[model samples]
Target: MSFRHLPSRALIASVLATVMVSFALRGQDLREADAQAMSQEAYEALQRGNAALAVREYRQLLEAHPEMVAARANLATALVSLGRFDEAIAQYQMALKEEPDNSSLRFNLALACFRKGDYLQAAQRFGTIHNGEPNNVRIATLLANCELHLRQVAQAIALLKPLEKSHPNNLDLEWILGMALIRAAHPREGLERVQKVADRGYKAEAYELAAVVYMGLTDFDKARSDAEAAIRIDPHASNAYLTLAMLDGYSGDENGAAEEYEKALKANPQNLQARTQLGIIFYNQRKLDDARQQFNEALALNPRSLLTLYELARVERAQEHLGTAVKDLESCVHEDPQWLPPHIELAALYYILKRPQEGAKEKAIVQRLMAEKQQHGPEPSVTGSLPPSP
Candidate 1:
């Protein structure tokens, strides 16, 4: 129902006219004393780390006083503490309508979106907030983080570069900016910052990043050393394990690579790259079912990943799901016309499906892409290596 339709609810107030009331009295249609006591109890629940109890109390309080913005914001915080991020986001959003300029509500909403992996949404909100408060290091750092997660390397670099100049010795800013620099293909500069952060005790993450920088520089020995150091500092360093796996795979030690990949997944089951790489291993081993499972899991983590989509399409085709494979391959082609691997796969599929015309069209695209590649020579890999040569 439209909120304007509820005049009775809107007009219901404990005091006939009071603009300078207590925080609790702002929205609840309750006597001042009762509102104070109830809100105080809810606040205490939050302070005591009893979010479930706070949620219950806040729900009861909001029931009789649906317009209570303060109470609703507190309720949203409680929901976030209890890992109910979606519920928390809803409450924050509703409260924002009542007080559109509430920074706390907007911050919490962005935080909830970030925690829920909606980095794009979180980035937009954080960007606005950061623009308004240029000196707010926390907000700027978080916005940079969101950019990194979204693969907007240039944006992240722009946000962090100025911060690095202003706060030269801050390890947090240095490490993050280092990562952005590396992604922006300035590995030599990136490595210097990462080394400083590592020397300053952010060993695990910095070492992991240094390993990647070394890989890009083709210093395999240094890459192995840094990766091993990262793992020693934190056994649960899944990315460290992933780096070691890549090293082994590149060295032609398939068994060692598989073991490292397994360890990486065990440390972090949600590591999408680890899952996808292991799936490729299974594919090379001719274990179609296992490869399919891993590809599907990676897709769940990032449904729009053309790499995963193409991998899954190959598995589907091998399993004789030609129609499904065709759809996925076509989607990949539409999403990235210049990408050659999917075109090659689609050409083979079209031929198998007895569509000579479509196959010839795909072949033509592949030929054009190859010509462009030859003219351009080969672009350097951004992070260590390219996708496994289709």
Candidate 2:
């Protein structure tokens, strides 16, 4: 060929070099050995959090030794660090199959299950681990969360009772156990337990939780006192103010509730719960425009707030805006069909609107939910006599 028309030798040489390199790397025993060594190196690297390097090594090792449990477990942990929970779960499964009783593997598996939103499976695995090491705080916390999600309040409380003995001074353990007790319908006992912490001067937050517990127990005087104590300690505690407002509302002091909600707003201008409570207070006091204003303000803060939606529906109903009320109530029902108050209010609103059949159906739903709640016990009376206004 003429030199001018000849192929570029450099191009041909580059392709040939790439082909030879590919062939040399393809299935060579030395290459496989090197990969295994690198995987081991990656496992060590993971201890130092070099996730990128570890991923490459472990992936190569897995290609050759697919059944290696140590490699698989390390890979799973590395996958977790890489935010690959699904892949981590698959790897953890393989490790668990190899060593069925590996607690660490099970613990990781449980966490992975939780991250995947497979809470039931996570709860079961956590329960098993808890049974083996009953005093493990992490597992207990996981178990409690699962129980709460599943609404197995009694089981959660029972699971936590033993933890109280071992972790007597653990603040979180006590708080969780107190909440579990309250959920299990022992609000009086729960408040007492929480008050013990508050009395010990832990923080104003304990007093706040204690106030909520007392409210649940219908011990309004104590609830008010505890809530006030929280406010006195930390004027910025919005929860304490919100709790006091609700307690006042339940005790038929709409004006007092409104004032407490105002204080709550001063502490946290964006407190949607307080705003919604203020709306409810206004609604109860027949201040229709003010109620609507508060609800609108709350909705502006959080368009998706369930309480605000429900209160807006209530305010609409009271204003005789039947269609708008129906729409708002429908939204609330869609958001939280399990909350008794909304269903009851919806049924009442429908009846008032002359939709007797729809009202009856809603009333039936309320009755069903009430029956279920009754199985727990007579509802604790959050309503109690308020001390004459100071």
Candidate 3:
């Protein structure tokens, strides 16, 4: 009668049926004991942070009692704790089917979707939850994050503004709102919001954000000061160094920018932004070897990054390695066909290499993409260069 003896699903179902029926007909507490014990064991495993064990126990319980919403919910939670987002999503869906009105189960499902990088589904689910509970700050924040990932900047800002008003001085909300505003092209307003946070004692992150805004505004001196202040507050803040490097590049101080980028990388070696920007600075300086090294490292980190590929191609072209440049540009174009810059560059390279037919093909694509871009308004500049002075 050991629980482990019930190996097959049919066996588990038969045993569960017998246990329930015997308990009901005989009014005997003994028949119900095994079922309660298994549930308690699952709870205890979860309490002890053994998510794998908890998942196993919950799954066993679920197989025996497929209609038990609590068991499904707990299994979903255990799967989430184990970083099994797809499985968690399935379990949560099952729990929701059993209890359609369960807000927590729906939220968990949305969270799993978000974690799995399905921003569209996450946004839809979070939007539904937000509609049901408009005052839920957590849901609003998560929904805004999904919107941001989907490049719905205006919608993110709209969602965050009310939360900012209701929860004044809340650092996370203010920070997100400020970033949303900046992304929405309201840098002045964003800077003011970030400045307010900094003045209110969130100096480190606030200063770093303000520095980025100042850099976008082309106020190099102010950007430098704010970035320095961020570094002073937290020397290991990789973003502060990266910002300083970008400001230096904008100010035509390539050497200083390179040094700052190195510092940023030292603080956090995985910072692809710092690596990419440093490569751009080196490329601009005509230091092809240095630029190639940085871009190659960045490409290793993010193989499909079109910007890195383009920059790497540029370096190869500068070094008169036309073949390598063509290969890189081909890869870049393959990754993003509508990207006009790579097509433009590739056309020129083809013409230079005496490949007139290939050149003409790329030129045609360039014209089409340019026309499409004009019809849709200008694409956002992803060149990582500083904005022109006003």
Candidate 4:
């Protein structure tokens, strides 16, 4: 009921109404006071560069005033600053629950998801925000990025094409679309387009993308050069070092790769990719125990990483733990059947162990796949042989 229409009918009603009005007024004053104090605390924390403390205060404010949108938004921002991605996502989701139609909240949630590697969810969330704000460059760029990670390269291309046209000569869009094209299997066209952008002083990101494309195309020297250029552009770019390590590994320079990976880890201690790459380098160098340790460490950080599991299984096989290797391989295959390398390794292991029946079954699968490849005629070479399962 409207406050103006609230009845003051009887003696008890009048007393209750007065008490209720006083209580409501006092509650409003208390909320205002609390909000002011929290805001001041947040500002002070920020000025002191104590992001973690700011996050705590903002979180407290949010807890006490669930409907305070400003507190909630600032809390999400603080969570990001603290690298608390999951917490930030939760807070953004809570904010969205209260304001479901808020595009900004949705965008923030998408960004949090992206940081946490939930690209598919991020892509979907960004797509919703894009629908609401079609011309938002940041949202569009993020959606394109999410599409690329989700391997929907064609969708990324489609999303960026019009944006590029509307804002002609936008280097960021051009280079992004170029990478999407390359990932989508149009390397020649993609490289040519990206080269144009690279020449226009959009060098660092463009070179990094070029490095990845060169790696995909098996042009190791070119990959190394571009990766080096990326490093020159940003001395502390962990990605450039890690990618260079991959190039070294692929080119059979174990020691060089190890050194590059060390630099990568030095630059970013949380570089799981670098750690995994280092593990594989050690594995290839016949350091089974070291490889296993690295894989274990990486798995501790990301339990669901099938690559780490596969690597551990491979290391176990190398150490002659056939049963353990098989168990891990089984888990890997069960989790992700489309990963062809694990299947090939599993089949090869069965063969090596003289389990002819099991070997025959796996052989049949590979042979069938090979037959299909032959039927298609002139299939592309599968690069980089996987280590045999011990």
Candidate 5:
């Protein structure tokens, strides 16, 4: 998802519009001819798509007339266009101190934070603006998306339901609301909303979302059908292929699963699930070198991925690289303290390395997790018996 979708408008255009509006000089007493010339040059640089030049000119302009609020705001916009979000944020903050009531500055600030992956901060900024301008659909939508990213499914659902009710047939809202509902374990209602988008020409994304819901329901046939529809709409629908591959694996057709995973990678080489699962297949077949290669490639794609780290540690352990495996597993354990798989594997590795005390501690945690699972009773897992071929 964005930083995933808006109300069917290009975000870049919005950014440009903000910049154009903020380029108006507020006529400060200190605004001299040199400062004006620099501002004009920076504006032209941006108009000509020379973002680096724009940044340079803006910085120079600000150095001369530090109190020029328009220059500061434009500098932030220029920095944002150059993908220097932290610099943009700093500029926005400084500009806000001068004109604290400027909603446009706050809006741009929220967007910069979103681009920087600070969803919580973005949510806070957007929330404040939304509160003041209760009818601003864009800020409301953005706030809902931030909630979605933070896994605040209940809040996202609550925020979106009224929006969808008021703004009937907004596919973007429907898509976002459907995601929240599905995450809240209301698959049927989510499927209904997503299907509306599919019927209205947002076929690929809608069908892909539907396939995920069906997969969760363990309705492999419907999942495959929806996934195939998505791929037909857009052959680059990597997640659809990923769902298909997962279905194939669950069906016990290893060769089919591998082929589907490869198809997924061909569609999107950076797909983490496809590469990781394919590596697990290789590991199960005892192709240690191939598995190791895949896991390493997966990690290279995203070093912060705890799943990939855990999987790579498993391969290292299988290859008898005990010490290397321990380092990776320990990192995983530190990052994902509540996850049972990493803890379980780390416990085994500790015992293998003859760290009996640490191993016993990990074993105790695993025992506690098992006890919790038992108390919760059996949750529905792989809800269907069979995965049919597409």
Candidate 6:
């Protein structure tokens, strides 16, 4: 879930272009003299970080000589630099049409798709490249990331397994593979992978991931230890304290949970999850004012957050602000119609407000959602929900 440690696709593309430009152009048919000169100027603009100028020049060159594959490819890279992913995708596709076997074109196309949030297409393209070049660890890693986002955990694990064997020291591979395993309900395997990374000197992020894996396995003591290790390695890691706080809450230690949550917020004030969890603790303890403060702060950070709205509604209801609570609940339900808890809560509130028909409608939705949950298995707890007591 954390790509923070990985080199960005843009950086990867730039490096690839630098290393492979000559190879990519080798044996290609020559463009006209004017087109070739314009392409060189565009490439120089790109090198100078003048992405907009590069894009304009490339577009003009492509307009004059649409068959110029290198110019089209360079245009795609410039568009990518500008964050114009859809435009970049178009240019890459056009370039690929001229040279379908070109690996660099295919890779850049896949990266453009990924940036556009078209993960399915990106995965398919990356998979095609991987099939042809299995030793390309970067492509494999990116393909695994696409699988993780698509929730194809088994596929991600399968994709990374052999690579992890060949490149045992790749901490990013281990981190992503561990997370995929955890999401696939193989927490023990995930824990082993993360712990191995931690033992290999990637203590901070590795221990943080290990703590989350332990929490998934319901090994609170181990989770606490890993969290503490993560904190000791990097005190500014807000996730470490958040994991510790979650462990504290699960163990019925509200005070300890609150303390850790506060520490987490202090470490990273923008940690919305920590603030939301702390608010839930306050709500459970009947500290309505304290709960509202945390929830309001979270709402200020993300005004459209459904969990914050739902929690803030609870606070408003506890304080007898019926109108405000109703408004908040209505907004929550509107934001996520299939969320069962809000429907149930809204139904009760509607009944109290003498809106019998609306209450009945909400209650029916709750029944349908509950039946669906029964078929699928238990729903995962959302933010602002209390942890099950130990």
For all candidates in order, the CA lDDT equals: 0.86, 0.81, 0.85, 0.80, 0.85, 0.86
Sort the candidates on TM-score, descending order: 3, 5, 1, 6, 4, 2
Identify the leading candidate in terms of lDDT: 1
TM-score for candidate 5, residues paired by index: 0.71
How would you encode candidate 6's per-residue C-alpha lDDT over 57-165 as one tens digit per residue? 9999988888889888999999998999999998898888889889899899999998888899999999999999889888998899898888888899999998888
| Residues 51-129 of candidate 5: C-alpha lDDT, one tens digit per residue | 8999899888888878989889988988988888999999999999999998889999999999888999999999999
TM-score of each: 0.68, 0.58, 0.71, 0.61, 0.71, 0.67
Instruction: In candidate 3, list every pair of residues with a backbone clash.
Output: none
Query: Considering summed lDDT, which 10 consecutive residues are worst modelled in model 5?
Result: 381-390
lDDT of 1 at 246: 89
Q: What would the per-residue lDDT of candidate 4 be over residues 225-266, giving only the tens digit for each residue?
A: 877887888787676787788877777788998999899888
- Between candidates 5 and 6, which one is better according to lDDT? 6
Clashing pairs in 4: 317-390
What clash count goes with each model? 0, 0, 0, 1, 1, 0
Better of 3 and 4 by TM-score: 3
Higher-scoring candidate on TM-score, 3 or 6: 3
- Evaluated at residue 333, the lDDT of candidate 6 is 83
- Shift of residue 374 alpha carbon in model 2, Å: 17
Candidate 1 Cα misplacement greater than 4 A, ranges: 1-40, 59-73, 83-133, 146-156, 198-206, 286-335, 341-365, 382-390
